[model samples]
Target: MKYDQIDRKLFIKNRKNFMAQMKPSSLAVFNSNDIYPVSADSTMPFQQHRDIYYLSGVDQEESILVLFPDCPKENHREILFLKETNDHIAVWEGEKLTKEAAFETSGVKTVYWLKDMEKVMFELMTQCDTVYINTNEHYRANVETETREDRYTKWLKQKYPAHAVAKSNPILQRLRSVKDPIEIDLMQKACNITEKGFRRLLDFVKPGVWEYEIEAELMHEFLRNRSKGFAYTPIIAAGNNANVLHYVVNNQQCKDGDLILLDVGAEYANYSSDMTRTIPVGGRFSKRQKEVYNAVNHVKKEASKLLVPGTDWAEYHKEVGAMMTSELLSLKLLDKADVQNEDKDWPAYKKYFMHGTSHNIGLDTHDYGILTEPMQENMVFTVEPGIYIPEEKFGVRLEDDLVIQKSGEPFNLMGNIPIEVDEIEDIMNS
Candidate 1:
C-alpha cells in the first residue's frame, strides 16, 4: 500500500451502519480479494475488496472480517480472521499485521488466525440465524473471473444449509453511496495529486509528443505523491482518438492542431478521484475548437448545479441532455427540426454527447450508488459532459468531481485545476 493510513473510525462507522440495517441475529462475512496469477509463479498485484476495506481498515490479503452484531458472546460480535504472520513471512514478503496491530488499525478486539477460521465460523453460525454474504452488485460491474469472496460464499452456504442467506450488497449500496468527511478528505487528496499530474502536462505537451509520453508523466507525478497509480485505465487520446470514449492505446503522436482528451484520475488510500480535461496539443485551441470547448464547459457548469440533494440520477441525465441540445443548436450542429423530430428515447443531442453526465465516485471510479434513488447530501459524483465530433476530427470533454450539499450548488473537488480557456492557454504558453 503506497498511500497513507486511513482513519479507522470511518471503517468502524461503516460496519456499524451496515450491521444496523441487518436483520436481528444476522451475521455478515467479507473476504479480501485474491492475488490473481498471471502465469507461472508471477501474479498480479493484490487489490483488497472495497467492501471489506470499507467495513474494516485491514488492507492485507488472506484476511476476513465477520460482523455478528447479535452474537451470544460479546467478543464474537466483531471478529477478524487474518493469516498468521511470523518472522518468516517478514523475511520473504513483508511484515503483515499482528494481533495487537490489527486492533489498533481496525479497532476490532478479537482476532483469529486463518487456521482457526472453520472452528470459529462454526461456533458463530450456531449462534446466528441468518448469514449475510458480500457480493458485487455495482451498476457497471462485469466480473467474469470468480473471486475469493465468491468461493467463500459458495462454501459457506453449502456447509450451513439450515442458515438463512441474505445479500450484503443492497445494504452496502445504500451506505457506501454517501461519503463521510474522512472519505471526502482522502478523495480530495487523490484529486489534488491528479491536479499535479494535469498541471505537469500543460507545459510538457507540444506537437510531436506521443500520447504514451503524457501517460508516463502523469504516472510519475502520481507515484511521487504516494498514489499506487491511476484509479482506472487512463485515456491519453490525441486527435481523432479523443472521439473514442474509451480510447486508451495512447500510442499516437499529438498533432499541432488537434485536441487531446485526458480522462485520468489518481487514487489515494483506496478512494478514487475522476477527472477529464481536453486540451490543445499546440498549447492553444483553434477558434472553432474554443467554441465547442466552451459549450462543453458551460454544460459541465450547468450540470454541476443540477447535482443538488433530492435530484434523481435518471432525470439529471435527461436535463443534461436538454442542456446539451441547446448548446448544440447554438453551435449550429443541429437545427430546429433535428430536435423537434428527435426520438424521445434517443435525443438529437446523443449524436454529440452520448455518455451520462454524472456518476457516483469514491471507493471505485464508477462507485456504488442506486441510480433509481434520489441524490443525497455528501454523495460524491462526477459531472462529465462531452461533445465528440468525429466528423470535425476532434472532441471536447470537461469533467469535475462534485459533492452534493443540503443547499445551494454542489462543491467542485477539482476546482483548483485549471479549466478555463485563458488559464490553460496561459499555463501552456507561459
Candidate 2:
C-alpha cells in the first residue's frame, strides 16, 4: 500500500460496533475480492472488499474475516484467515501479510492460512446457530459477475442447510454511512489531493489543450501525492461533451470560449472524493456561461446546507429541485407555462438538471446510506447540481463533498478548492 499505516483502533472500533448489532449466536463472514481476469496471464488490479477492509484493515486478496462474538472458544471470537506468506511469494509478488503483521493491521489475534479455512469453518458453523452473509445491496448496485464472497456463501449454505441465514448488508449500510473521525481524516486527505489536481489545471488549462491532457495532468498530481488515482473513472468532458453525463472519452480539443466540465477526484487509502467543477477554457467565462455557472453554484451552496442531521434525503432533493426550478425559470430555460405543464414525476427543472442533487460519498464513490432514513451526524454526501444545455453547446456543474453536522450546516471537505466565479477566474488569469 502506498498510503501510510492506518491506526488499528479504527478497525477495532468498527468490529465492536458491528458485533454489537449482530444477533446472539450469529457469525458473520467477509471475503476479500478476487483478482478478476483480463485475459490469459493477465488480471485487473485487486481491490479489497470495503466491508472486510472496514472491519479488518487487511487490504489483500484471498483473505477472510470472521466475527463469532459469542463463540465458546475465545480465539475464534475474531479470526482472520490469510493466504500464508512465504519467501517465494515475497520475490514473485512482493510480501503478503504475515500472521504478526495481520494482527497489527486488523487487531485480530487469531490467524490461519487459507489451507485451514474449511476445517476452521466447519468447527465455527457447528457452534453458531445463524450465519450472516455479506451481499451487494447498495441502492446503486448492479453487479452481474460472480464474486469470491458469492462462492463462499454458496458453499456455506450447502454445507449447513439447517442454520438460519441472514444478511449483513443492512447492518453494514447503516454503520458505514456515518464516518469515523479517522475515516473522515482519510477522506479529507483525498479531497486535499483532489484540490492539488484541480489547482494544477487552473494554470495548465488554456485553449487548444486536449481533454485527455487535462486528465493526465490530474493523474500526475494525484500519483505524486500518494493517491492511488481517481476515486472513480474521471469525466474530463470538454464543451458540448459535458452535455453527455458520464462522458469519459476525453479526446476532444478544448476550443477557445468553451467551458470544460471536470468531474474528477483523487482516492486516498481507498476512500473517495467526488468533485465537479466547470471552468472556462480561455481563462474567462462568457456572460451567458457565468450566469449558468452562478446558478449551478448557488444551487450547490444551498443544497449542501440542507445536509444537516435529521434532514430527510428525499425531502432534501425536493427542496433542491424547487430551488433549481426557480433558477431555470429566471434563466429563461423554462417559462411559467412550462412549469404548469411539466410532468409531476419529472419537473420543469428536469430539462436542465436530470440527475439527483446529492448522494452519500465515502469508501465507495456512491457510499452506503439508506435513502429512506433521515440524515445523521458524520454522514458524508456529495452536493452536485448541474445544468446541461446541449442546445447551447455547454454544461455547468458545481459539486463538493460535505459532512452532515449535528446542529448547523454541513462541513465542506472540498471547501478549499476554488468555486466562485471570481476566485476561479482570478486563479486562471493569474
Candidate 3:
C-alpha cells in the first residue's frame, strides 16, 4: 500500500461495534475483493473490500474475516484467513502477509491459511445458528460484476442451508455512516492532499492548456503526497462541457474566458475526499462569470450549514433546492413564474442547478449513509452546488467536504483551500 499503516485499534473498535449489534450465536463473514483480470497475464489492481478493511484492516486479496463473538472456542471468536505465502511465490509476486504480520496488522491473534478455510469454517458453522453475509446495499451501488464476496456467499449458503441467514449491510451502513475520529483524520488527510492538487492547478492553468494536462498535474501532486490518485473517475469539464454532469473526456484545450469545472478528489488510505471548483481559464472571471460563481458559492456555504445533526437527508436537499432557487432567481436564470408553475418533483431550479446539493462522502465518493435516517454527528458529506449556463458557455460549481458536528455548524475539511473569488484570483495571478 502506498499509504501508511492505519492503527489497528480502529479496526478493532469497528469489529467490536459491529459484533455488539449481531444476534447471539451469529457469525459474520467478509471477503476481500478479487484481483479482476483484464486480459491474459494482465489484471486490474487489487482493491481491498471496504467491509473487510473496515473490520480487520487486512488489505490483501483472497482474505476473509470471520467474527463469531459468542463462539465455543475463544480464539475462534475473531479469525483471519489469509492466502499462505512461500519463498517461490514471494519471488514471483511481492511478499504476501505472513501469519505473524497478519496478527500485527489486524489485531486478531488467530490466523489460518486459506487452504484451511473450509475445515475452519465447518467448525465455525456448527457453533453458530445464524450467518451474517456482507452484501452491497449502498444507495448508489449498481454492481453487475460477480465479486469474490458473491461467490463465497453462494458457497456458504449452499453448504449451510439450515442456518438462519441475515444481512450485514444494514448494520454496516449505520456504523460506517458515522465517522470514527480516526476515520475523520484519514479523510482530513485526503482532503489536504486534494488541496495541494487544487493549489498546483491555480498557476498551471492557462487559456490554451489541455484539460487532460490539468488532470496530470493533479495526479502528480496527489501521488507525491501519498495518495492513490482520484477517489473516483475525475470530471475535468471545460466550458459548456461542464453542463454534462459526468464529462470526463478531458481532451479539449481550454479557451480564453471559458470556465473549467474540476470535479476531482484524492484518495488516501482508501478514504475519499470529494471537491469541485470552477475557475476562469484566463485567471480572471468576467463580470457575468463572477456573478454566477458567487451565486454558486453562496448556495454551497448555506447548504453546508444545513448539514448539522438532526437534519433529514431528503428534507435537507429540499432546503438546498430552495436556497438554490433563490440564487437562480437573483441571477435571472429562473423567473418567479417559472418556480410557481414548476413540477413538485423536479423543481425549476434544477434546470440551472441540477443534481443533489450533497451526498455522504467517505471511503467511497458516494459513501453509505441511510438517506431515510436523520443526520448524525461525525457524518461527512460533500456540499456541491453549481449553476450550469449553457447559453453563456460557462458553468460554476463549488464543493467542499464537511463533517457534521455535535453542535453548531459542520466543519469544512477543505477550509484551507482557496474558495473566495479574491483568493482564487490572487493565487492564479501570483
Candidate 4:
C-alpha cells in the first residue's frame, strides 16, 4: 500500500459496532477481492473490497476476516487469515503482510496463514450457530462477475447446511454511510488532493489542449499528493461531450469558448471525494456560458443547504427538482406551458438537469446509504446540478462534496477549490 497506516482504533470501533448488531452465537466472515485478470500474464490492479477494508483495514489480497465474538476462546473471537509469505514470494511480488504486520494493520491479534483457513474455519463453525455472509447489495449494484465472497458463500452454505444464514450488507450499508471522525478526516484529505488537481488544471487548461492532457495533469497532481488516483472513471468531457452524462472518451480537442465539465475526484486511503467543475477552455466564459454556469452553481448552493439532518433523501430530491425548475425557468429553458404539462415523475427540469441532485459519497463515489431513510449528521453527499444544452454545444455542471451537519448548513469539503467565475478566470489567465 502506498498510503500511511490508518489508526487501528477506527477498525476496533467498527468491529465493536458491527458485532453489537450481530445475532448472539453468530459469526461474520469477510474476504478480500480477487486480483482480476486482463489476459495471460496481465492483471488489473488489486483493489481491496470496501467491506473487508472497512472491517479489518486489511488492504492486501487473499485475506480473510472472521469475527466470532462469542467464541469459546478469546483469541479466536477475531481472526485474520492472510497469505503466507516467503522470500521467493517477496522477491517476485514485493512484500506481503507478515503475521506481525497484519496485527498492526488490523487490531485482530489472532492471525493464521491462508493454508490453515479450512482447519480454522471448521473449528469456528463448531462454536457458532449462525453465520453472517457479506454480499453486494448496494442500490446501484449490477454485478456480473462472481466475486470471492460469492464463491465462499456457496461453499459455506453447502458445507454447513444446518447453520442459520444472515446478510451483512444491510448492517454495513447503514454503518458505512455515516462517516466516523477518522473517516471524515481521510475523506477531507482526498478532497484536499482533488483541490490540488483542480488548481493544476486551472493553469494547464487552454484552447487547443486535448482532453486527455487535462486528465494527465489531474493524475499527476493526485499521485504527488499520496492519492492512488481517481475515485471512479474520470469524465473530462469537453464542448458538446459534456451533454453526455457519462462521457469518458477524453480524446477531443478543447476549442475556444467551449466548456469542459470535469467530473473527477481523488481517493486517499480508500476514502472517496467526488467533485465536478465546468471551466472555459480559453480561460474566459462567454456571456451565455457564464449565465448558464451561474444558474447551475446557484442550484448547487441551494441544494446543499437542504442536506441537513432529518431530510428524507427521496423528498429532498423532489425539493431539489423544484429548485431546479425555477432556475431552468429563469434561464428561459422551460416555459409556463412546459411546466404545467410536465409529468411529476419526469419533471420539466429533467430536460436541463436529469441526474439526482445528491448521492452519498464516502468510501465509494456513490457510497452506501438507504435512500428512503432520513439524512443524518456525518453523512457525506455530493451536491451536483447541471444544465446541458446540446443545441448550444456546451454544458455546465457544478458539484461539491458536503457533510450534513447537526446545525446550520452542511459543510462543503471542496470549499477551497476555485468555483467563482472571476476566480477561475483570474487564476487561468494569470
Candidate 5:
C-alpha cells in the first residue's frame, strides 16, 4: 500500500459498532475481493472489499474476517484468516502479511492461514445459531460478476442448511453513511490531493492541449502526493464533449474558446473524493461562456447550503430543481412558456441541468447511504451542478465535497480549492 498505516482503533470501533447490532448468537463473515483476471496470464489489480477493510483493515486478497462476538472462546470472537506466506512466495510476489503483522494490521489477536479456514469455520459455525452474509445492496449496484464473497456465501449456505441467515448490507449501509472523524480526515486528505491536481492544470492547460494530457497531469500530481489515482474513471470532457455525461474518451483537442469539464478526484487509503471543475481553455471565458459558468456556480453554491441535516434526499433534489429552474430562466435557456407547459415529473430545468445535484461520496465514489432516509450529520456528499449547452459548444460545472454538520451549514472539504471565477482566472494567468 502506498498510503501510510491507519490507526487500528478505527477498525476496532467499527467492528464493535457492527457487533452491537448483530443478533445474540449470530456470526458475520466478510471476504476480500478477488484479484480478477484480465486475459490468460495478466490480472487486474486487487481491491479490498470495503466492509472487510472497515472491520479488519486487511487490504490483501484471499482474506476473510469472522466475527463471533458471543462465542464462549474469547480469542475466537474476532479472527482473521490470511493467505500464508513463505520465502519462495515472497520472492515471486512481494511479501504477504505474516500472522504477527496481521494481528498488528487488524486488532484481531487470533490469526489463521487460508489452509486452516474450513476446519476453523466448522468449529466456529457450530457455536453460532445465525450467520450474517455481506451482500452488495448499494442503490447504484449493478453487479453481474459473481464475487469471492458470493462463492463463500454459496458454500456456507450449502454447508449449514439449518442456520438462520441475515443480511449484513442494511446494517453496513446505515453505519458506513455517517463519517467517522478518522474517515473524514482520510477523505479530506484525498480532497487535498485532488486540489493539488486541479491547481497543477490551471497553468498547464492551453488552447491546443489534448484532453488526455490534462488527465495525465492530474494523475502525476495525485501519485506524487501518495494517492492511488482517481476514485473513479475520470471524465475529461472538452467542449461539446461535456454534453455527454460520462464522456471518458479524452481524445479531442481543446479549442481556443471552449471550456474543459474535468470530473476527477484522488483516492487515498481507499477513501474517495469527487470533484468537477469546468475551466476556460485559453484562460479567459468569453462573455456568453462566463454567463453560463456563473449561473452554474450560483446554483452550486445555493444547492450546497441545502445539504444540512434532516433534509430528505428526494425533497432536497426537488428544491434544487426549483433553484436551477430560476437560474435557467434568467440565462434565457428556458422561457416562461416552457415552465408553464413542463411535465410534473420532469421539470423545465431538466433540459439544461439533467443529473442529480448531489450523492454520498466516500470509500466508494457513490458511497453507502439510504436515499429514503433523512439526511444525517457527518455524512459527506458531492454538490455538483452543471449546465450543458451543446448549441453554444460549451458546458459549465462546479462541484465540491461537503460534510453535513449538526446545526449550521455543511463543511466544504475542497474549500481551499479555487472555485470563484476571479480566483481561477488569476491562477491560470499567474
Candidate 6:
C-alpha cells in the first residue's frame, strides 16, 4: 500500500457496530476480491473488496473475514483468513501480510491461513444457526461477472443447506454510509491530493495543450502526493466532448476558446474524493462560457446546502430539478412551451443536466447508502451540477465532495479547490 497505515481502531469500531446489528447466533462472512485476469500471463491490479477491508483491513487477495459474536470460543468470534505469506512470495511479489501484521492492521487477534479455512469454517458453521452473506446490492449495480464472493456464497450455501441465510448488504449499506471520523480524515486527505492535482493543472493548462497532457499533469501531482490514483476513471473532456457525461477518451486538442471539463479525483487509502471543475482552455472563458459556468456553479452551491440531515434523496433531487429548471429557463434553453409539454418522467432540465445531482462518495466512488433513508450526519456525497450545451460547443460542470452535518449545512470537503471562474482564470494565466 502506498498510503500510511490506517488506525486499527476504525476497523475495530466498525466490527463492533456490524456485530451489534447482526441477528443473535448469526455469523457473517466477507471475501476479498479476485485479482482478475487480462490474459494468459497478465492480471489486472488487485483491488480489495470494500466490505472485507472495512471489517478486517486486509488489502490482499484471497482473504476472508468471519464474525460470530455468539461463538462458543471467545477467540473464534472474529477471525481472519489470509493467504499465507512465504519467502517465495516475498521475493516475487513483495511482502504479504504476516499473521502479526494482519492482527495489527485489522485488530482481530485470531488469524488463520487460506489453507486452514475449510477446517476453521466447518467449526464456525456448526456453531452458528444463520450465516450472513455479502452481496452487491447498490442501486446502480449492473454486475454481470460473478465475483469471488459469489463463488464462496454458492459453495457455502451448497455445503450448509440447513442454515438460515440472510443478506449482509442492507446492514453494510446503512453502516458504511455513516463515516467514521478516521474514515472522514482519510477522505479529506484524498480531497487534499485532488486539490494538488487540480492546482497543478491550473498552471499546466493553456491554449493548444492536448487534453491528455492535462490528464498527465494531474496524475503526476496525485502520485507525488501519495494517492493510489484516480478514484474512478477520469473524465478529461474538452469542448463538446464534455457534453458526453462519461467522456474519458482524453485525446482531443483543447482549442483556444474552449472549456475543459475535468471530472477527476484522487483516492487515498481506499477513500474517494470526487470533484469536477470546468476551466477555460486558453486561461480565459468567453463571455457566454462564463455565463454557463457560473450557472452550473450556482446550481452546485445551492444543491450542496440541501445535503443536510433528514433530507430525502428523492425529494432532494426533485428540489434540485426545480432549481435547475429555473436556471435553464433563465438561460433560454427551456421556454414556457417546452415546460408545458415536458414529460414528468424526463424534466426540461434533462436535456442539459441529465445525471443525479449527488451520490454517496466514500471507499467506492459511488459509495453505499440507502436512497430511501433520510440523509444523516457524517454521510459524504458529491454535489455535481452541470449544463451541457452541445449546440454551443461546450459544457460546464461544477462538483465537490461534502459531508452532511448535524445542523446548518453540509461541510464541503473540496472547499480549498478553486471554483470561481475568475480564480481559475487568474491561476491559469499566472
Which candidate ranks first by lDDT, i.e. highest?
2
> Residues 307-377, candidate 4, lDDT per residue (tens digit)?
89999878888888898899889889999999999998899999888888889988888999998899999
Off by over 4 Å in 4: none
Task: Name the lDDT of candidate 4.
Answer: 0.93
Count clashing residue pairs per candidate.
Answer: 0, 0, 0, 0, 0, 0
Candidate 3, residues 3-111, lDDT tens digits: the string is 9888989999999999999999999999999999999889998888999998888989999999999999999999999999999989999899999999888899999
lDDT of 5 by residue, 213-318 (tens): 9999999999999988999999999999999999999999998888999999999999999999999999988889888889999989888899899999999999
lDDT of 2 by residue, 1-430 (tens): 9899999999999999999999999999999999999998999988999999999999999999999999999999999999989999999999899999999998999999999999999999999999999999998899999999999999999999999999999999999999999999999999999999999999999999999999999999999999999999999988899999999999999999999999999999999999999999999999999999999999988888888888988888889999999999989999999999999899989999999989899899999999999999999999999999999999999899999888899899999999999999999999
Per-model CA lDDT versus the true structure: 0.93, 0.95, 0.93, 0.93, 0.94, 0.93
- Candidate 4: deviation at residue 279, Å? 0.3
Which residue ranges in model 1 land beyond 4 Å of their true spot?
none
Task: Output the TM-score of candidate 2.
Answer: 0.99
Per-residue lDDT tens digits of candidate 6, residues 292-403?
Answer: 8888888888998888889999999999999999889988989989889999999888999999999999999999999999999999999999999889989999999999
TM-score of each: 0.99, 0.99, 0.99, 0.99, 0.99, 0.99
Q: What is the lDDT of residue 301 in candidate 5?
A: 89
Count of backbone collisions within predicted model 5: 0
**TM-score of predicted model 3?**
0.99
Model 3 worst lDDT run, 10 consecutive residues: 356-365
lDDT tens digits, residue span 137-203, model 1: 8878899999999999999999999999999999999899899999999999999999999999998
Scored by lDDT, model 3 comes in at 0.93
Lowest summed lDDT across 10 adjacent residues in model 6 is found at 290-299
